[model samples]
Target: MKVDFRYLGRSEVREIAGGQALSFAPNLARSKVFFDAEIVHPLRFREAICALHDVVVGDLKFKKKDKGAYEAWKRDQAQKQEQVRQTLLDQARMRELAAVVKEPLPKNLKGDFQRMHRLYWDARNKWALELSRNDPELFRHLVPCDPVVTVAPDMVFFECFAKDESSYGFLGVDRGAFRTEAGAGLGTTNVDYSLALYEHFQTLRSYRPTRLLVDPSGFEVNIQGRTDYREEKIDLPASWLRGFGQLQAAMGLPSRRFELSVDVVYSILAFLKRHREKAGPRSLRFQLQPGKPPTVVLEPWGIPIVSHGRAYEGEKAEEIKVWGRRRLAPLARILPLAERFEVMLFGSGLPSVWTARMGEMRMVLALSGWTANDWTRGSNLDQFFADLQADPAAVDKLAGHLEQVRMARLTTLAEQTNVPRSVLMGSLHELARRGQLVYDFSVDAVRWRSILPVALSESMLGPEPAELVAGRRLAADPSTTVEREVMMARGARLVVANVGQSACEAVIDPDGSLTRAKCGCSFFYKNKLRAGPCRHLIALRSVARRSVVATTDRSDLTVHLMSGTYAELRAEADKRTVATGYVIEHAWRLAREAIQRTASLADPTQAAGVYRTPAKIPQSLSLPRALVEEIQREAARLDVSVSVVVEAAWSVAADQIRKSSSLLN
Candidate 1:
C-alpha cells in the first residue's frame, strides 16, 4: 500500500514569552484533524513521546555478520602494501637520478601533496554531512511510516509500530490532562515526526509552560512558495499492515491481568541491564496465586523479583512464561514518572502488554512472543481468530455506531445494536482486525481509531497459510469423516478422523492447544508441527468443532424445552423445526394431552402441578441414558415426579449458560 503525507512545515518547538509551543504538522492528504491544548504535565508528555520514538526506530532482530567488512579490510591491507612498494622504488630511482642528472626535486612537493590529500577528505566529509541535512529521508529509510495520532472526545493518543515489526507502542493522554485552546475536530491522522523533533522534546521541563498543537492551520495556509513544505510517499509492505492488525486483535482476547509497582519494574530492568544470558529457556516466568503478590522469576539464572502491588484476585494459580524481555528497555526512562505498571499476559509463548500509568497518561508497550517471532509470522496466535466467523454486515453496523459514539463498552454496543453478544464480539474483532477500532485494556472499552486513512482489506493482510486453506477444503469435502471422538477428563478430547486418504488422530487440551497429533500424510512425517499442523490435523479439528456445535445446539434445545415458557420454547423449537422437519409444536400439544390423560395414574395434587402449560413444555427429547437415569434417581430421592426433576435440572443448566456468557461482556 502506498501512503502520501504532505506537511505544511516540519514539526518543531518554538520559544514563546513564558513557555514553549510544541506544534505537530499532520498529513494534509488525510482528514483534517487538529487539537490545541495546554499541557498540564510537560515532562511526562515529553518522556512518553520520546519513548514512542524509540519504538518507532527500534529493531532488535539479530543480523548476520556482514562479509563486506572482511572485504574492506583486505582492500586496506593491499593498498598499504602497494604504497610501501611504490615508496621503495621511488627512493631507489631518486638515488640513481641524483648520480646522473644532479637536479634537486621540488622541496615542497611531498608536503603539498599531503596538504591536498587532507583538504580533499575534509571537503568530502562536509559535503556528505550537508547532503544528509538537506534530505532527512536518506537517514530514515527504515521508518517508512510516521506515528498515527487520534483525537477523540475522551482522550488523544499516538500509536506506532516498530521498524522490526516486533514491538508496538501506544501513548494516551486523557482529555482531562489537557486544557483545550482551540480546534475540537476528532479523527486520526499521521503526524510529521523525525529524530530532530525527538531532540526538541528533551527541552521540555515542568518549570516551563507548553502548549500541544496538532496544527490544522497548515491545511488552510497556502504553500505555493513555502520553503518548509514537503511531501513523502511510502510504499508500505503488506507485512506491516498484517502485523498491526494481528497485534490489535491479540489485545482484545482474554488475558491474565495484573499490576506491578514502579519499583518492581525498576528491579526487572536493573537485573536485565547487569546480566546477559547465553543459553536456552530465556523467559520471564510469572508465579501467580489468589490473594498473594505475584513473583517474577528470571530464567537461566533463577532470580526472583516479587511485586509489592495488590494481591492477585484470580480464581486459580497459574505460571505463565513470556519471552522478549529485552524490549522492555524503552520503559526505563519513563519509570520515574510512572505510578504503577499494569500488565496483561495472554499466555506463555504469546504476546504481552505492559502499560506505564502516570496521573492521566499511559504508555503501553506490546511485545510479540520473541524478537524473531513477529506478530505477522506468529501462526499460533493467528489460529485463535481462524474459526471466528465474522458477519460483514454486522461489522459494518457496529462500526458505524461506534463512529458516532467514539468509544463504548461491549455490553453497551450489544444493547444498542440488539444483536447477540457472541455475534457482536466477532464483529468487533473484525473491526479491530481491519484497524478501525482499538481495545483499550485500561478502561475495558473500544475506541474508534483508524490506523490508516482507508480500512485494510483481506488482501492487504496477505493470503491464508497454505495448510489452513487445504484443510478447509478437506473439511468441506464429503469424503472427510470424523470417525470417533472420545471425551477425556478435564475437558480434553481424543479425535480420530479420515481425511482424504489418511487417518489422523489428535489430542486437544482443555485450552485448545494441540497436545499430540499423528497423521499418515507425508507433510506430517517430514516437518510435523514445526511448519504448523498438517492438512489432515486441521481437517480433523474442523470436523470436531462442527460436532461440538451440533451437541451444543441439542443441549440448548433441551434446556429450553424443560425450563422455558410457552412462547420461548416455541421460538427455539421453531428454529430446530426448520432444519429437522419435525412438527415440534404439534409434538408438544400431543405430549401435553397424553399427560392430561395419564393424570389419573399419578396423585391428583401432583398431577395438577406437573401438567402446568405456562412455564414447562412437555416435548419428546432424546437425552443421554445416563442423564435420564440421574434425573430419575434425583426425582426418587426428592420424592417428586420426573417432570419436576427435569424442570429443576433445566433451571440449573440455563443458569450456568447465563454465567458463562456473562464472561464475554
Candidate 2:
C-alpha cells in the first residue's frame, strides 16, 4: 500500500501573546477532516500525545548479537584512553615550558578558555541540527508514518502503530474536551508529526490557552508550486494494515474486561523498573474470582499487585496470563492525570488492550501476545474470523446506517437494520476488516471511520499463509484420517492424527487455538509455533473442525467454488495429461492450468491445436446462428475442426462446474 501525503506546511506550535497555537498540517491526499478547537487541558493533552509519539517510535524487538561488536568496542575504548593520556602529557609539558620561560598567562585566560568551549559546543549543536534537518533518510528511519488523526462527531482521536509493528496506541479526546470554534467536516486523515513537533508539544502548559487546529485553511489556499508545499510517498507494508485491522476486530470481540486501580498499575510499573528479569515465564497472570478483587501475579518473581477497584462479578473463576509486560512503560506518562485503568484480555497468548481514562480523554495501548508475536503473524487470531462469512447486502445496509449516525451501539444497529444480532456482528467485523469501521471500546460503540480513503478488499490485505493453504488441501482430502480426538476440560480438545507420513498431536484450547502442538516433521521441529503452526497441526485442526461442521445444521451453506480443491484438481489434471487418450483430455489439461493461475474460464472459444482430431459431445448445445458461424470461422482460422473448438469450450465449462460443486466433506 503506497500512501501519499501532501502538506502545505510543517506542523508547528506558534507562540502568541498569552497562549500557543498548535497547528497540525494534515495530508491533503486524504479525505478532508477539519478540526480547530481550544484545548481544555493542554498539559494533559500534551502528555497523552507525547505518549502516543513514544508508541510510534518505540521498537522493543530484540536485535541479534553482532559477533564483532565486543572487539570493536574494546578497540574504540583503547583509542579514547590513549588520546586522553596524550592530551594530559601535552598539557603538563606546556605548563612546565611556561614555568621555565617565566612567561605567565593573561589575566583573562580562564574566560578565554570558557568562551572557546562555548563556541565549540554551539558549532557542534548547529551541525547536529543541520544534519537532522537535511537528512531525509535519517528522519524517515526515525519516524515510519505520520500519526493517523480522525475527527468524528463524538470525539477526535489519533492512532499510531509502533515501528516494531507489535504495539498500537490510540488517543481519543471527547467532544466535550474541546471547544470547537470552526470546521464542520468529519473524517480520518494523517497529520504531519515529527520529533521536532513533539518537542514543541512539551512547551504546552496549563496556564496557557492552547488551540488545537487541523488547519483546513491550507486546503483552501493554492500552493501547487510553492517551496513550502511538500509531498511524501510511503510504501506502507500490507502487514501493517493487516495488523491494524486485526487489532480493531479483536477489540470488538468478547473478552475478559476488568478495572484496575491507578495504584495497582503504579505498583506493576514500579516492580518492572526496579528489577530486570533475565529468564523465562515473564508474564502478568490475572486471577479473577466472583466477589473478589482481581489479583495480578507477576511471573518469575511471584509478586502480586491486587486491584482495589470493583470485584469480579462473573460467575466462573478464571486465570489468564498476558505477555509483553514491558510495553506498559508508556502508560506511566498518563498515570498522574488518569482517573482509572480498564484492561481487556482476549485470552492467553492473545492480544490485550489497556486503556487509561482521564475524564474526557482516553489513551489506549494495545499489545500483541508478545514482543515477537506481532498481530500480522498471529495466525491463530486469523482463525477466529475464518468462518465469519459477511453478507454483502447486510454490510452495505449497516454501513449506510452507521454513516448517517456516525457511531452506534451494536444493539442500536441491530434494531435499526432489523438484521439478526449474529449477522450484524459478522457484518460489523467485516466492516472493520475492510477498514471502513472502528470499534470504540471507550464508548462501547462502532464508529464510522475509514482508515483509508479508498475501498479496501480482502485481496489488498495479502494472500493466506502457505501453511494454511496446504493444511486446507490436506483437510479436504478423504485419505487424511483423524486417529483420535478426546474431549478436555473447559471446551478444549486433545487430538492425535496422522498427516501424511508424520504423526501429530495437538492440544486445542477453548478458543480453537493450539495451546500445544508437536509433530514429526522437520518444519515443526525447527520452528514449533514461532513461525506459526506447521502444516500438520493446521491439517489436524481443520479436519477436526470439519467433523464438527458436518454435525451442525447450517442452511446458509450455499454452493460456491471451493478454492481449497483447486490445487487438487490441478494435480489430477497434471497426472491425466501424461497419457492423453482423446482431444478432450488436452483441453482439460489446459483448462486446469488456467484455473491454477486463476485465469478467466468464461471464454475458451479459441481452438487449441494440441490434438488434431475432434471429440464429439453428447447432446450438443443449439447455438445462435451468428455465434455458431463465429465459432466455425475461429476453428477454420486456427486450422482445427469445429468439434475440437466446441470441445475446448465444453471442457472449460465442465471445469467451472467441478470447481463450484466441490466442498470440504
Candidate 3:
C-alpha cells in the first residue's frame, strides 16, 4: 500500500545487480521473499536475469514411486503394519529420524496394513530432498534467488522459476521505475535480504542519483534505473499465471522478424569466444530471405556468418534453426545499450523470442529450449497455445481498443474488431490473461495494462473466463464428447468426437462466425485461428455462438480442422447416428481391406499391400524422418506403442505385398 524508488544515482545501477546471497535448495519451499527492494532496469534487465538463470533444470532425479505401488499401497491397509509402525515411530523426529535410513521392512510383508509407515516416510523424505537438490558439488549454490514481484500501479512484474519449474524469469518494472509513498509498505524479504537491498542500491546505482528520497519511513527502498530491483510474491502458478499471457505471445510465431545490430551481437560474442570447446548441435543458423541479409550459421562449423547487420524481411526463403545459442548471452550485456536486436524465430526446438531496443527501453527474452534442453526435454511451454476460445467478442473489442487509444495496434484492433488479425491474436492473449492487458515494449502496442492493488482482487488474475473452462469441461464429462452430424448444403453439420479422436466441428452456423469451425488439433496446425478456439472449437462454438448469423455461407460449411479421419469420421458419424454397429462394421472391414490391398499400386511407395491394409481411403503417409526416429526409439525400447511399431511395420509391408502381387499376376 506504500511504494517508492526514486534514484537518478547510477553506479552501474548498483554494480549491475548480479548480487549474490540467494538460497533455496534447502529443498525448495521458501519463496515468500516479497520485498528485498530496489529495481530499475537498463543493463539488459540484469543480463536477462543472468541469461534466464542460466537455464538450469540440472541434474534432477525423482523417479521412485512404485515399489509395486508402494507395495500395493501397503496391501490395502486397514491398519496394522505394527500398528502403523507405532504411528510412524511416534511421529518421528530425532532430526527427522536421523534424516532417514531404515529400509528392511519388505521381506515379503505382503503389504496392506495401511499407510505403510506413511508411505515409507513419504518416499524417504522425497529421496532426501532429491539428494540434496542434485548435489552439483554440494547443492549447486542453492539458487531461487527469490524474484517474483508484482507492484503495479503502472507496472512492476518480475518472475523467476527453476529448481525445475523447468525455466522462466520475467521482468516488467517499467513505469519509469515507479516511485511513491506516504505511509508504510515493505514486507517481503529473503536472499540475504535481497543482497542487502542491493548493497543499498549500490549507492544509488553507483552514482546516478540526481535526487533520491525513497522514504517509506526509511531503511532503504532504493531504485536507480539500471536494474537490480526486488519485491516479490512467490508460489504463483496457474502455469505461472498463464505464463504472463502465453509467454509474451511468443512474438506471435514469427515468420521471421529479425533486426540485429550491435555487430550481430559482437558476431555472437566472437562465436562464443572461439567456440569454447564447441561440441554441440550449437546452432544459430538463420539464412532467411525476402530482401536478404541474416546469414548467421556458426554451427558445428557449417560456418556462414553474413549480415552486414540485420535485414531478413522474410516473405519466404527460410531456414531459422536457433538452439539455445548460449541463451543469447544475456543479449551481450545490452549490446552496448542496444538500438535494435530483435529476433522471433520458431524453428529448432521451438520458443526463442529475444528483443533489446534500449532507448526507451525494451528487453524481452523467452528462450525455452537448449542447455541440453534442461538435460533432454522438459520446458515445452505446453505447445504455447492450443485449446483457445476466448473472444467475448474479442474481449469486447479489447475493451473497445483500450478505450480509443492509449495503445493497441494489432492492426488497430484488427480494424476495430471485424476480427481476424489472426483471430485478434487469441483475443489479445485473452486480454493478457485478465489483468485486462499490457505489453508495450516501448510501443510495440497492446495497452490497458494494470495497476490493481487496493489490496489486490480481480480474482487475483487466474481464471479469466475461457468459457468457464469450456463449461467445466462440458459439465465434467458428458461422455467425454462425441457429437458429429455433417451433411452440408448449409444446414445439418456437427461432428464433436472426444472418445478417441476426430474432435471439433459444428457448422450450420446460426450466429457463430464459424469459419467452418474445425478442430483436429495440433493446436490447430500451430496457432491458425491464432491460438483461440479448440475445445472442440470451444465446445462447438459455444453451441454456435448462440445461434443468429443469418447470412450464412461460411464457405458452405465442413472445414473440419485436424486430428481427423477417425475411422472416416466414425463411419460418417455412424450413418447419421445409430444404425450399423460393431463400430461401423469394424470400420468398413478395415476400409475394404485397405482397398483390396492398395488397388494396383501405381507407386504407393512401390506397393506392399500398400503398407498393410489399415484402411479404405485413410491414406496419410510421411514416415522417414529417420524412420520416425527409428519408430520412436523402437517404441521406447520395446515397452511398446509407436502404434505397435507402426502396425508391425505394416505387417511386414503386408507380407511383402502378398508375395509381390503373386509374382505380378
Q: Which candidate is the best by TM-score?
A: 1
Instruction: Give Cα distance to truth, residue 436, candidate 2, Å.
Output: 2.0
Q: What TM-score do all the candidates reach, one by one?
A: 0.72, 0.69, 0.27
The 0-to-1 C-alpha lDDT of every candidate, in the order given, reads 0.72, 0.72, 0.45
lDDT of 1: 0.72
Using TM-score, rank the candidates from best to worst. 1, 2, 3
Candidate 1 Cα misplacement greater than 4 A, ranges: 67-141, 379-382, 455-457, 486-537, 552-665
Worst 10 residues of 3 by lDDT: 20-29
lDDT of 3: 0.45
lDDT of 3 by residue, 1-665 (tens): 11122222221222223432111111012211222233344244444444434432322333356688777767758465578677767777555765555646666565454448657746654654464445522332342334434333344444444444334544454555423322212212112223444444333332232221122211333343433332322223333345456554654543357776667677877778766643867677777877867777777778777767646776678786766566555456556667776776666555566666664345566555554343113332323333345667866767675745545566566776578655566667666665455555434666654322222234554444453365346634545444434333223334444522446554433223333446666665664443344445555544433232222223211111122234533443344442212122223223334423443322233443323333333223322244345445655655644443444433334334323322111
Candidate 3: segments with Cα more than 4 A from true spot: 1-259, 262-339, 345-354, 357-463, 466-528, 538-651, 654-665
* lDDT at 606, model 1: 56
Model 1: per-residue lDDT, tens digit, 1-665?
Answer: 56677889889998876889999999998888999889998988998888888888888788878899899999988799589788999999999987977667789988898779868956654654454456533333344468889999989999887777788888999998887566668999999998899999999999999999999888799988775676666655566666665665675455888999888889988999998998968899999999998899999899888999998888789998988888998998899889999999877777888989888898889888788777666534545433556888888888888899999887587898776765776687777768788877667788888877887878776687678799899999999987776444344557778999999988765445455679999987964543357888888877777764225422212322444433443443344322110223123222333333432324322533445344345445443344455545545665766655444333323333323322111
TM-score for predicted model 2 compared with the true structure: 0.69
Per-residue alpha-carbon lDDT of model 2 for 1-665, expressed as tens digits? 55677898889999866788899998899867889889998988999988898898878877778869899988888799589788999999999998878877689988898779868956654654454467633433454767888888878999888877788898999888877466647888888988899999989988989998888977788887775677665655567667756765675445888899999999999899999998979999999998999999999999898999998877679998888898998998899998999999877767888999999999989888888787666634554433445789999998898888888887678888887765666687778777778777777788887877788767787887777788888877777777765444444556788887789988775455676679999987865654567777888887777654223332211111123323333454344321111122233334534433333223343333233332322322322344456556655665655555544544564554345422111
Lowest summed lDDT across 10 adjacent residues in model 2 is found at 554-563
Cand. 2 Cα-lDDT: 0.72
